[model samples]
Target: MPSAPGTGKGGGPDHGYPPVGRLLPVGGGVVHALTTGSGPDVVLLHGASGNLRDFTFDLVGRLARDFRVTAFDRPGLGHSDPLHADGESPAEQAAVLDAAAGMLGLGRAVIVGHSFGGSVAMAWALEHPERVAAVVTLAGATMPWPGDLGPWYRIASTTFGAATVVPLVSGWLPDSYARNSVASIFAPQQPPDGYLEHVGIPLTLRRAAVLRSNVRQVAGLKPHVAAMARRYPGLSIPVEIVHGTADTIVPAAVHAHPMSRLLPNARLTKLPGIGHMPHHVAPDATLAAIRSAAVRAGLN
Candidate 1:
């Protein structure tokens, strides 16, 4: 792997953001993980178009105060290699992360996932039940939504888009555009100071592989979640769900509400007037959810 040039307007290798953790070889490629603190194990999986830095920005430090935390850059994003070109499903991502967790000696842990990571968390618990003590989702897209995704998703997942539009958009799209996109995700609640810099926006958008993986994963998420939803009742482990009422990106009514009803031991926290990034906007609620999960899981 090469270094990113810098987190400037344009994207290139060595975007000046070096890995803050070790790159462990997993299977054919490597998985980048930043581990810290001490106590019961807590594995954090970030959303699409993001890396482990999202947790390291604020949430990880808070959680680390009481529990051992490992934040992974999901395959095909950040420094982690893509599992395959066709796009790795949430189950595939979960399997790879589980392997990486085993290599790191992580035993049964409270798996926390945000957005796309939430789906991966579900997959993780479903596929490797013995390793998961509990589960937590922050505005997770757990169930399939009614309608199709936007035009960008439809176009970007195609062969033409992957070869042409992906590279063009990754290289030419200005930093302002990307910043605005980030801001929109956290609408109704502004992004915290220095979040754009800390989250590695340039690396997220500039890399064609990252874009392709994200596009395909998101485009194909509905069917996967639909399948996962059927098995929710089989999961008896405690689950804590945190979602913002105002989060249009992954609406609570669509995912969290139904999920709570499905899971036998599930608690839902709905933050009024909050948007998609509930973990950042409402850290208190997010922290509370994690603590609740830990206590319930007997890990505290």
Candidate 2:
């Protein structure tokens, strides 16, 4: 893979590509995320077990034409330091995002969240409706956490939780392990090789607290979903939801379909034959959804 022009060892700007991965102090510790493009501010949040680099390089560059995109590594995922304070729930994560946006001088902007990030975006919009210009959720976990996530998810969650006991031990999580685990959530086909490596695999593995926080974030979804879904009726801002009909990770029946039904002003776009990671597999369609959502939100 060609290295982004000026991006250095740490994924910073190296070849005039603008910094693709960097850290910014949000509240207490630094928040790890990537910023590129220039236009209406659009915050992109990745899913569970993912960092900022999850957004495809081409997608970020294309979106930059109309929107300044900021894809953040939720607490503990990438270069950002783990959250040490209480209230690391989805709602709290949204608050952290709000603060980060302010610090970056971003006014009301659109939010595009994928998988777990979608949940955070919804919670953020519910809490601070005025700050959000619009929202686009891609295969987001809008419904309550399913009771059955198969044995693997349970084991992984438990393992991740236990790993948090010792920082040193947790830091030893292998890049292969992280990559394989993430790959399992998608279709049989794998993403491009070295994708995780380029996105800071070692940094994420070292952040045990962030992993633990993510496990808790996943577990606490039921109540958050219930409450947030109810608040959708009050949302005046435009909303868009895109989900692959064949998604296996979050399941379309629970999230995309239900969320569309609840949100009076929301539009749902179904992608046939695609899986959970549409942005990686179908960047153009994902970009279209984002642009459509932005237009609906009056960001044109």
Model 2 Cα lDDT, one tens digit per residue, 1-300: 322332212222222223346556666666656677888778988887666777744467778888888888676455554554332577878887787777777877889889989998998899987789889898898777557555533544565434545355455666677778668766744666666556554444554555555655665567878888887788877888889888988888889998888887898889888889888777788888888888887778
In model 2, what lDDT does residue 280 have?
78
Taking every candidate in turn, the Cα RMSD to the unseen true structure, in Å, is 2.8, 5.6
Best by lDDT: 1
After superposition, the stretches of candidate 1 with alpha carbons farther than 4 Å from their true spots are: 1-12
TM-score of each: 0.96, 0.83
Query: What tens digits encode model 1's per-residue C-alpha lDDT throughout 131-219?
Result: 99999999999998998998999999999999999989988999889888999999988999999988888667877777888888899
Q: Give candidate 2 misplaced runs (Cα > 4 Å).
A: 1-22, 85-87, 148-176
> Residue 218's C-alpha lDDT in candidate 1?
90
lDDT of 2: 0.71
Q: Please list the C-alpha lDDT of all candidates, in the order they appear.
A: 0.88, 0.71
